[model samples]
Target: MQLITAHVMSKHLSLSSFSFRAPQDSPEKAIPSRKLPFQTFLSFNPKKPLSLKTHLPIMQISKTLFVFCLISCLSMTSSQEQGATAYEMLEKFNFPRGILPQGVRSYVLNTDGSFEVYLDGECKFGVEGGYSLSYGRKITGKVSFGSLRNLKGVSVKVLFVWMGITEVSTGNGELDFYVGPLSASFPLSNFLDCPQCGCGFNCKDIVSDS
Candidate 1:
């Protein structure tokens, strides 16, 4: 009787253990599994294929490119306008007797449309005339008028001449001067020489000995 009872108890325990294990292998009881959230987010959804998340990088690149292009275009336009202003000033003055010496070359137009001339890496002069002739460095100068009649359009012309002088080549020892129209001319003497006696004749009236 004891042996029979022990056999029956062992059979009952084995049956219980098998029943618990069987459910674990069933599809319904298994742990739920699917793609990760991040991976799913990256994939183009068939229902909403044009989602912002899916196209985020492309949008970012497009925005960046647009900003870059806009900046580049604005910079180019600004530069062109500055150049045009300088040219108009030059035309207005019409340096008829090209004042800059042969070796002097133009550099660039300043913001104020003044011409700058350089000789041996040094500033030579800045010319501006309103009702009179004003000549000196962009920082300092004196003004004189041959006649008020000559002063017509004088301001614009003088500004252009100053701009032209400022643009002259500094590497070369040559000095460039502007006369009346856009005619660029080179004088026969050094820039520092007396205007009364040297190429300064064009610049003499405005230039002072002191």
Candidate 2:
């Protein structure tokens, strides 16, 4: 009777353990038993797939990138309209800003490349190499890609007399300034600064000379 009762108790304990253990042969049924909230929703409806938690961050990132690009484009357009100055315009024509002196109060540039430059007053300054130049109140010229034609209101002192520079041209890495039938050529690097009136190359020297 003791042996039969021990056998019955062991058989009953084995049945209870088997009932509590998860079955390995059927993983599909076990998935539903431990399904997450989002998993349950997806299982119910196969047509609507993505959850809000998964897609919300992607939408937010896309919106942020779009706003950043829009602001950048607007800033560039505003700068092109308001930030462009006369010196920067000269750069567009492949000329150095130093070709024109400072104190440009106003200017008019036409679509045909003809332009007029107005200074604060007549600019007269002696360059470093003993050359005195004078620019009139208004200077008119037709500017091409690398040449200037029909230039007026500019002159240079030669000996005791000042002669007008009627034509100016640049090519072959040199700049040519013409007066009537006479012309002079200098290296293109010479006109890098627009000399100031009455100051020459060094204003301090002019002050000392005075």
Q: Which candidate gets the maximum lDDT versus the true structure?
A: 2
Per-residue CA lDDT of model 1 for 15-37, tens digit only, reads 22221122454565543333333
Root-mean-square deviation of Cα positions for candidate 1 versus the true structure, in angstroms? 24.3
Each model's Cα RMSD: 24.3, 24.3
Evaluated against the true structure, the overall lDDT of model 1 is 0.33
Per-residue lDDT value at 157 in model 2: 92
Say which candidate scores most in TM-score: 2
